[model samples]
Each structure stands twice: as C-alpha cells, then as structure tokens.
Target: MAQKSAVAARAPKKKASSWQKRDWVAAYIFIAPVTLGLLVFYIWPFFQNIWFSFNDVNKFNMSTFVGLENYIKLFSDKEVWKAFGNSLKYVVITVPAGLFLSIFIAALMNAKIRGKSIYRTLYFLPSVTMSAAVAMVWKWIYNEQMGILNTAIKAAGGSGHAWLTSPSTALYCIMLVGLWMTVGYNMIILLAGMQGISVTYYEAAALDGAGPIQQFFKITIPMLTPTIFFVLITSIISGFQVFDTIYMMIGKTNPAYDDTQTVVMLFYRQAFDYGYKGYAAAISLFIFIVIMIVTVIQLIGQKKWVNYD
Candidate 1:
C-alpha cells in the first residue's frame, strides 16, 4: 500500500490540469520583460531622483543631504514666484479659450461643404507637423518689424507694433500660436465625438420644428459634453507644461523673457544653469501639487456639466 501511494504521488497530481500550468507559464512570459525593464530603468531611477532631490547634488563627488532648507529657499525666491504667476496666467489664457475655440472650429468644419477632406487635412496638418519647424515659422511671423503680421497691420493703415518683443503682447503672442497649433487637434477629436451621435436625434429635433441654432444648443452641446470635458482636462495639463514654445521663442537675454518664463522653464534654468538641483526639485514638487489640485477641482466641477451616458 505504501509503494502504491508513493507511485501515485510521483505521478504529478494530474499535471495541474494543463490549463493551470499554461496560465502560469503564459503570465511569466508576458511579465518577464516588463519586470526586468522596470527594475533596471524606472524603479531604480525613480528612487535615485528622490535621493538626488534631498542631496546637495555635487558634480563629481558624493552629495550631502539637506533637510527642508531647499524648500524654504524656494518659497522666498522671487523668480520662482514670478514663474509660478506666469504659468497660472498662461493656463488662464489658454485652457478655456482653447477649448471653446476648438469646439467652434469643429462645428464649422462639420458643416456640409465642398472639399471637406482638403479642409480637414489642411487643419490637421499643423497638429501633425514638426513643432520645431512651426516655431521657426512663427518666429518670423511674429518678428518685431519685418513679420507678416506687422506688414499686414501697416497695409491696413494701422501702426505696426512690436509682436513677440513687446512685454505687453509677448505672452499673448505665444499663447495665440499655441492656440493655432492645437486647435486642429482638438477639432478633429471633437468632430469624431460629434459624428458618433445618432442622426435620429437631429432628425427628431428637426421634425419638432427646431432650427439649426436650436438643435445645436439642445442636441449638439449636450451630446458633445464628454468630448469637451476630455479636451478641457488634457488642454489644461498641456497648458501647464507650456515650456518648449517659450524656450524656443523667447531667448534668455530677451527683455520679454522675464514676462513669459514658465514654471518648467524656471525649473530647467535652476537645475541646469544655476546647478540648484534641490531647489529645482522643490519647485517641481510644488508645480506638481498645483496641477493636481487644479485638476481635481476641475474634475469635481465637471460632474455638474459633463455627461456620462
């Protein structure tokens, strides 16, 4: 009897029913590469960033640990505060205006028209085209004296004022370019959402003697709420991250730089140019907090406006 039991045990318990063993093997294979990569790259580097944020960050030697002194200095720094204010201004100017403008453009593009494909391609071209090239083109377009904008103003019997160089209009000019660059992307997204709505809803409204304007407010706006909500959230996040355009358009020595510098731009200058890694880390953390708070508030408010079904 003991010999029979030993033989039964050695038979492998029916081989885990096949499916169980296969599942285990498949899971391991699927996760192995991701697990290894995360350990070597993301997981390791994330800890190192945290460590570096607490240390003095010396160039070729061991870094000394500092407490909250870096954070304290950040709160008192005027330039840091200025950068924060500028970032807020940019978000205020861009987010709402951009969302509305995108929706309006999408509505216009959705209308029955000739060469609709060509019009769509033309609009979407900016969204897909290289940002570096776009910046270079806009730089010339916003040129203080010789730009197309100024020439147009002159031809229209108006004074050709400074565009990007003027402190008064520097940030606005950048914001306008950003708006133009992103409008097509937002329009395309909104248009897709609009198209997904059933034609029966519009037909019903028309049968009820509703006009185009009435149908838009009653049907189109309500149907497009989810898309608008999504666009708002994404646009706000991207607006906070408005750095590349500012860095490209406004040089370090430019007089308008002071007015247009953003939080990320300040973080870059502090971390690299001035070698204030800890302080930069503190500013970055604060910016993260600000973005989180703003996004949460917007999401909460969206509950009142955004349609789920």
Candidate 2:
C-alpha cells in the first residue's frame, strides 16, 4: 500500500510552470510602483491623519496627545455645523442633477449625428479647463454690479441680483459651476460604457417592435447600470471633497463664505489659516467617515442593480 501511494504521488503531477511564475513576477514588478505609491502616499497619510485627529498638534510639532478633545470642540462648534450643512446641501443638490444631466448628455453624444466628434470635444471643454481659471472667470460673471449674468437678467427685464455674493445664491452658483465642469466628464465615461455595449440588444429590441424610447429604458439603461454606478460613486466622492472652487470663487473672507463653504474648505481654513491643526484633523476625520458611510451604502445598494457583462 505504501509503495502504491508513493507511485501515485510521483506520477508527475502538473506543477505551475516556471514561465507562469516568471509572468506573475513580471506582473507584480509592473504593479510595484503603484502598490508602493498607495502604501506611501495614501495609506501612510490616512493613518497619520487619524493620529493627528486625536492629538493636540501645533505649528511646530505634533506636540501633545489630546485624545478626542478636538472632536469634542468639533461637536460644540456652530461654524463646523454650518460648513457641514453647506457640504450636505451641495451634495444633495448636485448629485442628482449632475447624474441626470450627465446621462442625458452621454445618451445624446452616443447618437450617430453629424459633427459628433466636435460636439463631444465641446462638451468636454469644461472638464479640461483648470478649476482656478474657471473660478476666476465665473467670479467675474457673478460680479454683482457688472457681471454678464446680471446684465443678461437686466436685459431680460428682470432684477439684477448678486449671484455669488448673496448668501441665498452663492452655494447655488458654486453648484452650477460644478455642474457645468463635471457633467461632461461623467458623460464621457457613460459614453465609453455605451460604446462597450453590444448593438445586438438594441437590434433585438427593434425586432421585438420596441420603440427607441422603450429600447433605451429597457435595454440601454439596464446595460448601463454599472457605468451609472461608477459615475455616481465618483461624483459623490468628488462633490464631498470640493474645496478649491469654493475657496477661489467664494473667497475665504467673503460675507457668504460660511454659507457656501464645505467641510474640507472649513478644515483648510481652520488648519492653515487659524493654525488649528488638531481641530482641522478632527473635521477631516469626520468628513472621511461621512464619505465612507455614503460609499458603503452605495456599494450595498448597487449589488441589486449593477449589471456585469
């Protein structure tokens, strides 16, 4: 029996070849840079942010451990709530609007029309434009007295209002700019997803006497689920982290700043401007938790509808 077992074991069981091992090694080598980058840049910073959040760090040093003192201050602060509220409001108003418009534009762009490339390029312009430049241009356009938007309102026989300067409208104006710049980016991604879908489904739908609208709702939308999910997640992530546009457009010292600022913007102000590093870290940590919660909810919900091809 022992001899029989030894023969069975030695009957040249197929091992993974050296070439396969070499290929795996080569792939790991190629991925090493990105893996190392994540470890150093992302992972380390993440842990450090958490550590800083719990400590009474100052300008010169990570001086003392305060153990949730910063967090306590965050809860009792009215300004923190204002900034957080602004961020939540921005997310609520922007996400759905952006998602709908992006999908609509993407559908239009996918159509076989004359000058399609030109249209795509035109639509994508805002995405390529720098945020600083866009903010500067929009700042001029939102000028209370001389801006083109107010001038247009006056031309249309309507009252001229301070768009960005007004607390009532400043956040909305910021949202509008965000919508303009990003809608096309999401469109591009959706368009790519549309391209990946096989036309046979559409052809099949047509053969079944389905109209274009029916085909879109029943076939296109279902197949595009994964893409929509990706776009939605990314947009939410970006919207929550918004800062530069708010800073440049709203101005740090603007009267409307508190109403238009985000949590991240608040963090920046508290950390760099006020030299409250620990407080900023605490705010940052809260923002991180909120983002994580949103993302996890989306992931859980997506399991029901995200179609894989």
User: What lDDT tens digits, residue by residue, belong to model 2 across residues 186-296?
Assistant: 999999999999999999889999998998898888888889999999999999999988888887668887789789988998889888888898999999899999999
Query: Candidate 1: how large is its RMSD?
Result: 6.0
Model 1 lDDT tens row, 91-112: 8988888888888878888889
Question: What lDDT does candidate 1 reach at residue 283?
Answer: 76
Q: After superposition, how far is residue 287 of candidate 2 from its true place, in Å?
A: 0.8
**Every candidate's CA RMSD:** 6.0, 3.3
Candidate 1 contains a number of clashing pairs equal to 0
- Find the candidate with the highest TM-score and give its number: 2
Model 2 weakest lDDT span, ten residues long: 300-309
Best by lDDT: 2
